[model samples]
Target chain A: MKRLSRLALAAALMLALAVPVSAQVSDGVVKIGVLNDMSGVYSDLCGPGSVEAVKMAVEDFGGKVLGKPIEVVSADHQNKADIGANVANKWIDVDKVDVIVDLPNTAVCLAVQKICQDKNRINLISTGASVILTNKNCSPTGFHWTYDNYALGKGTGTAMVKEGGDTWFFLTADYAFGHDLEKSTAEAVTKSGGTVKGSVRHPFPCNDFSSFLLQAQASKAKVIGLANAGGDTINAVKQAAEFGIVQAGQRLAGLLVFISDIHSLGLKTAQGLVVTTGFYWDQNDETRAWSKKWSARMNGRMPTMAQAGCYSATMHYLKAVQAAGSDEAKAVAKKMREIPVNDFFAKNGKVREDGRMVHDMLLAQVKKPEDSKYAWDYYKILRVIPGDEAYKPISETECPYLLEKK
Target chain B: MFELIGIPPQALFGQMLLGLINGAFYAVLSLGLALIFGLLNVINFTHGAQYMLGAYVAWLLLNFLGINYWLALVLAPVVVGAFGILLERLMLRKLYHLDHLYGLLLTFGLALIIEGVFRNLYGISGQSYPVPPVLTGGYNLGFMFLPLYRGWVVFVSLVVCLGTWLVIEKTKLGSYLRAGTENPTLVQAFGINVPRMITLTYGFGVGLAALAGVLAAPIYQVKPTMGADMIIVVFAVVVIGGMGSIMGSVVTGFMLGLLEGLTKVFYPEASNTVIFVVMAVVLLIKPAGLFGKAS
Candidate 1:
């Protein structure tokens, strides 16, 4: 019996030794999770297109890092904070995922950020617009990519106010996104010596806006600022046209809009409406080239700002992991912050210590019906706000991560 | 004291007009929901999706069939109602003998399937429908501009709601429906086809929802999610009105819409949640709701 036990022990030891060290050393494969609002308002921004963007980045990086193949997986968080946290925890603890990317909704992004901090994993937030991700709730492992509410509001509001369409009235959505946008745009309007006469907060997904439009008309503000996004924005704009609010000498400023929203509104309704963002398909030669490739791959849906950010952030994460020679979350995260992320979307963008990725923002105006020489011709680039001017001052953010010593 | 917080006359009257417009939609949709639930005993969670389907049908008719709004206004509801009948015959009829909750579950599943397919195909972005040439412009009231289309929706929905009420309350078919609801087996013995009545009742209810959708398409974007958001508020409206009387649902839907408009003027922060708060208060005071029958 003693001889048999010794032989069994030897056999087990030899079997363990025969297994490749790469599997045990975390060098065989790196796994990343992409979680976002897959079927809600932000779906177009980061749904299937986002997953494809991440996959493309992996392919661009040769699909391997540190002698290991890289793998990508994704889930739809459905815009719920609890659901997002659950997915993040499962990705980290069960699947042993090293990174999570492209969380869209602000509440969900904040909740998932806490989970990443606890698990010591990296989270690349590309679709969310709240500044708080890089503010009070910032974590060393969380990186805020793409545009946030402050950048969009300031970029669009200041430019429009400077153009002498100063008196403003807001038709805002009733949510965190709308609140933040209204606050930021209000500040910009006030800062530029423009008066905010009044504002109306509409219920989200409200199908009719006659009452709100009536209030806007009564306010008689020169610029009717729309501090809403997605379907709400389109509905508000369309109703405004029906009410003849635009022809009544009031301008509509779409503080945050995507190409998809413009498509829904059509050129006639959306024409001359000014908005601001960090990405547009027709802005530059590089963007157009990348968009053409992506459109072909995505069956002709143009890449939104969130999708572009996903591509840039995923490429950067893989490159960092390759440079670090390990899938250890802390080491790879530190390398990511140190490296300047370069892409077709944003040139020489740097991830700040507070986890905010600083990039140049753009202002674009909706093209008129006659301006459209082809399909998908939505916006014409108005101006590019430099990186320093686009974002809030670093001192303004209350992130603890930025306060900590390097 | 009322005037201090009171809406301006122009604003009040304008908002009330706006309220009526919103109430028209609420009245039509809730009426449909109440009717379907009354006989079919299914919540028809896909009611909103069906409404969206109505709008998309109108859009497709215009785009593909070269049918104008007038034609679409007639055809869209038929198309959507037929689809509703198909849904009932295929899936909903199977759950009648089970607990009422099963009916709710089945319809909810159908809702998910319909919404999922639409989201996958068209995405969340809205599609615009042109205002018919006749209702394109607005009439300038001294206080506010009133779009002709808004006025039309309110008028048409009122006529439709009353017409439906008349048919259900006065007609022989409606009496048989009422009898069948009271005693299905007895009604069958009385030489009435109870099951077919239930099926047609569901179809009628779905047709009402589709008509509302057709009316709404020009005013709102033809989006996949248009129905999902509206349905929740309509549920709140149903709870507040108690869904006991056809006229009660219609009246309450308009009243609450005006109240919401007033809230937008006075306390903008609570505008989104005001209806829900009213619902909670109503539940606390009268569990059966203002017009609802007590279980």
Candidate 2:
């Protein structure tokens, strides 16, 4: 009877040992979590569209790395920091996701940044524009992809100033992202020898901007730099058009404009607006082909820059995983910086030591209603600012990781 | 160089005008809430969703049936009001005898369902409704440009608020409503169809919210979440106005809107919270509310 009990205990131990071995070999799946604002104000920019974009990247990468199947999962942050952190923890612990991508809001991005640092998982931020992501809060596991507010401000601010828009007024959203945008753009305006006449900070998610536009109009500034994103930018621009601020000969510079915002405003109202973008779907044949595939799955809505960046970032991460021959976060991240990111979205894109993805950004103006020949044909590219000239210089970076190494 | 308190007058007046337009919306929405609360004793938490429905209905009419803005102004309210009537008979009426909290909770659940359905149908990115051709441009008022559509919104909202006030305060039907609100049992003893009156009153209150929604469509993006954002502030306005009289909501809505506007000019940071701050103060100093009668 004692010998029978010992044999039974040995079988139980074998079952426990066999489960995780199969999990690591037969179905060694690599999971990527797309944590974003799936159902909120920023959904149109990076919600379900981004998820599909990442999936396309996986398919294009042949769907397996080191003989392991790649799977995609998603969760909505609901634009809350605490909820984002909780989702991050679950994705890292319970789901064993190797990478998290496409976080749009700054508050949620910062929250997830800390969690990724704690877990040593790769965080590929595709939509967040806060400069602090690469500055004070930089982490070894975090990569600020697409564009940041500093780059956006530089792209649009320099262009506007060169066009003789020497005087400026800013209508800023009152939040961390907004504050960073205004500061960065203001610095760019000053560097270009332009003077800032005045500025006002309006509450975020503000329904009305009539008063703020009037203040910009009253400032008599040559350009009104709108340092906001998503719906805030659309509303301010729509109201600025209504108030005849643009008709009065002042330019409206959307520092962080997206294709989604232009679509929301329609070309008629958004026409003549100067903005900067990391990718325009119709910019080239490769982009058009990829965007066609994206739009087919996205219900005919073209991919925004943020969504496109998701595809590029995910594809590159998978490539690095294969190159490193492991799904380890530190190994994949180090390989990410070592390789050049070449995809339909970004060509020759280089990830910096500070985890800032350096790529060429475009300066585009909204096509006039009559100028637009087809649907979703909104931008007329004015110039291409090279990757080196677009992003903030590395010497100026305040990332503690970089600073400590130096 | 024309400045007020170190700020330009154009900025000040522009914000105030915007504030007044916002006030117009507040007055209309709060007026509906107050009317429903007075007759039904339910908080009508679905007010925001109902308001959103009004805009969606107008958008559908224009897109699908080629209905113009004027027709939608009349038609949207009627359609939404009919929905409200059906809801009252089938659902809300069942909760009439229960606690007021139950009514609030049930309507709140209804609100989530309504918002969820809309969100599923048409994501959160709002659909744009253009300003009517006739009211497309604005006249320069020297200090600031006043868009014609905005002026129309303010004017129509005032007329509607006043019209609702006169109907409730002066007319014979208004007398029935007031009597029913005061003592429903006594009013029923006087040979009136009290249940039918309650149903119609709920419909009328809902219709008022739809009307405001139609007015707001052109100014704000016609989105599912639009009403959700505005309704919370309107509740604060209703609380401050105290649901005491029909006109109280109108007066307080406009006054607070203007106050919020002035706050934006003086202290832009507090513009969003100023209304709630006032609510807290009012709650502390006068729990009965400014216009509310002591229970």
The number of clashing residue pairs in model 1 is 1
What interface root-mean-square deviation (Å) does model 2 yield?
1.2
Tens digits of lDDT, candidate 2, A81-164 = 999999999988888888999998889999999899888889999999888898888989899999998889988999999999
- How do the residues B181-232 of candidate 1 rate in per-residue lDDT, one tens digit apiece? 7688999998988888888888888888888889999989887888887888
DockQ values for all predictions?
0.63, 0.61
Model 1 residue A95 CA deviation in Å: 1.5
TM-score: which candidate is best?
A: 2
Worst 10 residues of 2 chain B by lDDT: B2-11
Once model 2 is optimally superposed onto the true structure by TM-score, how far is the C-alpha of residue B3 displaced, in angstroms? Answer: 5.3
Candidate 1 segments exceeding 4 Å error: A1-27, A404-406, B1-6, B178-192, B242-244, B277-295
- Pull out the clashing pairs in model 1: B242-B292
Candidate 1 chain B: worst-modelled 10 consecutive residues by lDDT: B1-10
Candidate 2 — which residues are off by over 4 angstroms?
A1-27, B1-4, B8-10
The candidate 1 chain A region of ten consecutive residues with least summed lDDT is: A19-28
